[model samples]
Target: MASRSPRTTIFLLLLAVSLPFVCGCTDYGGQGVEQWSSDIPGGEAGDAVFNTPVQSAFTGEDESGTGFALQRIQPVMDGAAATEPRMFPVKFETREYEIDIDVNRSVYEGARTVDKALPAEYWYDEYRMLGYYSSFIGDPAIVTFLDDVLSPLERIRRSDNLNDEEFLELMVTFVQQIPYDSGAPVYPRYPVEVIYDGKGDCDEKSLLLLGMLSRAGYDAALLLFPEMHHATAGIRISTNGNPPFRTFTTSKNEKYFYIETTVPTYIGLYSENYEDAEAFVVPLGNGEKRFTRVNYVCHITESYQKIADRLVFMEATMAEWKQEIEDMKSDLQYGTYDTQDAWDDDYASYTALVGDYNSYVEKYRKYAEIYVYIRDRPYDIAGVYRRIENSNVMDITI
Candidate 1:
């Protein structure tokens, strides 16, 4: 139980790197922004415009001077997204709607050699496209953003008189408040960028939530629903509980509720459309992300219990040490021990107790941190992803 889980280790490395990003890079002030064209309202949700090549400024009739169309996409790794890269339930107030997202917009689909200076426009696309390009496996900048946000929440672990579920609720609320930017780029947002830019789409918000939750010591994951053309974040809870939204169960039988990081939605209350959709849950930064399917039966509360048990012991020990020191101070002031020899001996014992208290304080802090990282991890997940895997937004299905 003391050993760090692979996911936790990845988070630590990210956090270590993240230390620098506390003063985040603001404003992607590029030369020019790449404009995106998606169906506003009139265009068909499932139309061929997605497959239509985005004619570039570089393209023409030779002296018609247009560059040849780029081969932007190969087929996605899975056939689920063959028609569209992302789909989702739009209005949660209705609980009946799903948003059809066409990730057909590919600013950067593959590696390119810069023959000329390229163009300032492509550079801007590359900046917006950065989130899409990353799998978010142990990124330092992301971890740093997580560290800053979680530092405040970490106090909750030691704060007094709070229900076990209170922290989870607070975490969900914190993520829910993250501004949802519909106009941002199509792909996900890097965690730090979300903080600096003050907005993100579902995919971007999800990564931010994942980073914060991971640092705070919760078992967090990224859930992709291709059929709905949407992605959201979720945290591993102890049980499958009384039925509700979809849940991903690991090989060891841990259950996680699909929490929507975009909107402030309830944990188990998801859109009817997304309730039954197949979800591929990725535990960010855990090596070889093997997806665990949503299940209705069998779950484990060990992760919750493990953390609670450790905290209870540490808290109790901390209290006892504080009381001991206080009592010694009171005795010394009152002159309860008359003999000088007796007083000197008592003082020695008092100093040793103080040392013990300080040591445990530091020890518990570290233990809790590791506890968050390890227990919040998916157990026994393993597998290899394809060359071009669908992570945040769905890859356009050929």
Candidate 2:
């Protein structure tokens, strides 16, 4: 499909008006979610770890961190709506892939240097862990990292037949088997700790789950919130029925399910209180090329709309409006649009243009088509401007 156009004046206004509440402080950056199955190489193919009736080593501790419980996970709520499929695939040869490889070696190896595994200090700043993993997984540079590194590991685990809930339980069980290090302390623990000492912390546990999930061929993402970083994998949202979930397949005959690897919580457990936070996903299919935001919510309040309309009223007057577009065009042509600098520039220009209304609409009407051409998208603002420009009726106010 052709690229979507950038929002015209009206669209920009609408977007601003429709802005969702900014997520509370959280570092949400990581590779898209991946699911692994027994077909890959190491893990169980289609069995749930919890359902196997394995005895728990830790039980009965609550706030003081002394006990463990095998509480049955509650079923996930049927939320607002089924999510759309991933919009873009990780382009095999893009710059995203190269970045991820470097990130993998850096963080993966960096953790090994620390003497202790699963440090307490690192728990607070989950972003550091997220950055390291995101660098590897989400970066388009390491397109096949999920398949190459994680698949073989899952093959050995033989978790090929497990469903999402089962797989999550299995991961928790696997972690529970290894005790957290209480003697020594390290800032960041090594990935080797999972097998080396059979222990890991939040990031380590999450990564282990990520690796296994990737091998299973499931699409998932890492979620970073102010206080915690977690994982939320996708389950087919459209199907209807009790225990309705999408299945995972390894070979032609074998299949597994989605798992929530971060928490000890089982799969099939999500609700408004326990929700799916915003995440970035790497699509497995051949589709778009950008890292589309996932699980995002936008709410348009009347107050926001009023502000947006006023902004559009002013943006059209500045001669620099077209100049800004030209600059963006040049940057895009040379591939600088992805740079932080470019985003900053766009933010500045957009912010400045929307400061005044009458002048903004006047200029926008004259060049609405050209703006649409450059942006490759239309907007409510553009519609308004197009009408005003074509009709030459300048008596509208918001």
Candidate 3:
């Protein structure tokens, strides 16, 4: 849900092809390295393996540094629902080669207008930490927290034999399960603190999950929804994936699949408020931070097909219901309906069918409206899945 940047990062295309779906991870689990290739045109991305920790970055001792001095404060698990401070690896893969990153001991929290006087460090989209050599500021504390979060799940993930595509879903589910607390003190909490605190608001949770994705080697970025006071992560995903959502192109034009971290969801799914909200894409120094576009269609073909199927079924059902009602009315009007008991039974059935028909009509109307919306909206297909997934769940009504 992150947004609100002085700059506009929206790339408008009324309809673009769906991003490629994540493929199976094969045997890349355990210690084997997985190499990735460039799916987007401009980037020369190839081979990235998260098999080993970026050990060297956290190794060196810093006597003095120019960057912001940050100490890993032991976070207090004040609430009973805290995550108990455990680490779980983010499981994903790219078909590229290995790339090295140097984690700077002193990380710079880039130049953003900071009202030093403000009591709560309400992080805004303007405060995108400098993402250079210090791509992810490495602190022993943050590293350990990440490990704690990721380690416990290694066995379970391995046991499930999850592929990269499947792994992304699992990873997102893990982040969503974290309890949310809006009362995080003003300052931005390190991934460690967020984990220890157990509850995190949108921005805090987004960073913690982003750190995990960085450690696990999936390409991810920051999405600031400033106007909405929300933050979300955008992960690198193939344009052809089944995640019925759209992506945002970085200033460099590299597309990152939008994901909602504060709430548990598959990548590219988000709130209705941001359905057409302009997302500010903050780069994480992952090569090709600039989004790339290939003159594509955005909405899922399968989604459209499903809608068509439903439309056909609804139309057929509506016709049958109408016919039944018409026949029942004709019999009564012609006085050929026989007994009062028969009349009562027929009336009741007619009423029930009327209700059903009305429901179908409303549903079909929504489907058609969504179809038109998807056809014309720029870079937003998330509603297709959101509506489809949550559509039929009913509430009790007399």
Provide the TM-score for each candidate, comma-separated: 0.38, 0.29, 0.49
Give the C-alpha miss distance for residue 35 in model 1, angstroms: 25
RMSD for all candidates, in order, please.
Answer: 21.0, 22.7, 15.3
Under the 3 Å rule for N, CA and C atoms, how many clashes does model 2 have?
A: 77
Selected candidate, larger TM-score, 1 vs 2: 1
| Tens digit per residue, CA lDDT, model 3, 130-201 | 211122224444544455455544444566675554444555656655676655544455554455445665
The runs of at least 3 residues in candidate 2 whose Cα sits more than 4 Å from the true structure, single-residue gaps closed, are 1-110, 114-131, 135-190, 227-238, 241-264, 270-398
Q: Per-residue lDDT of 1-398 in model 1, one digit per residue for the tens?
A: 11221222211212222111011112232211111111111111221111111111221112342232222222223334322333333221112222222332111121111111123333323222222222231233223324544444445434533343544555555555566776765334444445545566656666566554544445565554544445556666654354433566655665666665555544533555565766655443321221132221112123223444555565666666677677788888786676899999988988998988787776666545544433322211111011112221111111
Comparing 1 with 2 on lDDT, the higher-scoring candidate is: 1
Best by TM-score: 3
Whole-model lDDT, model 1: 0.41
Report how far residue 127 has shifted in candidate 3, in Å.
Answer: 6.3
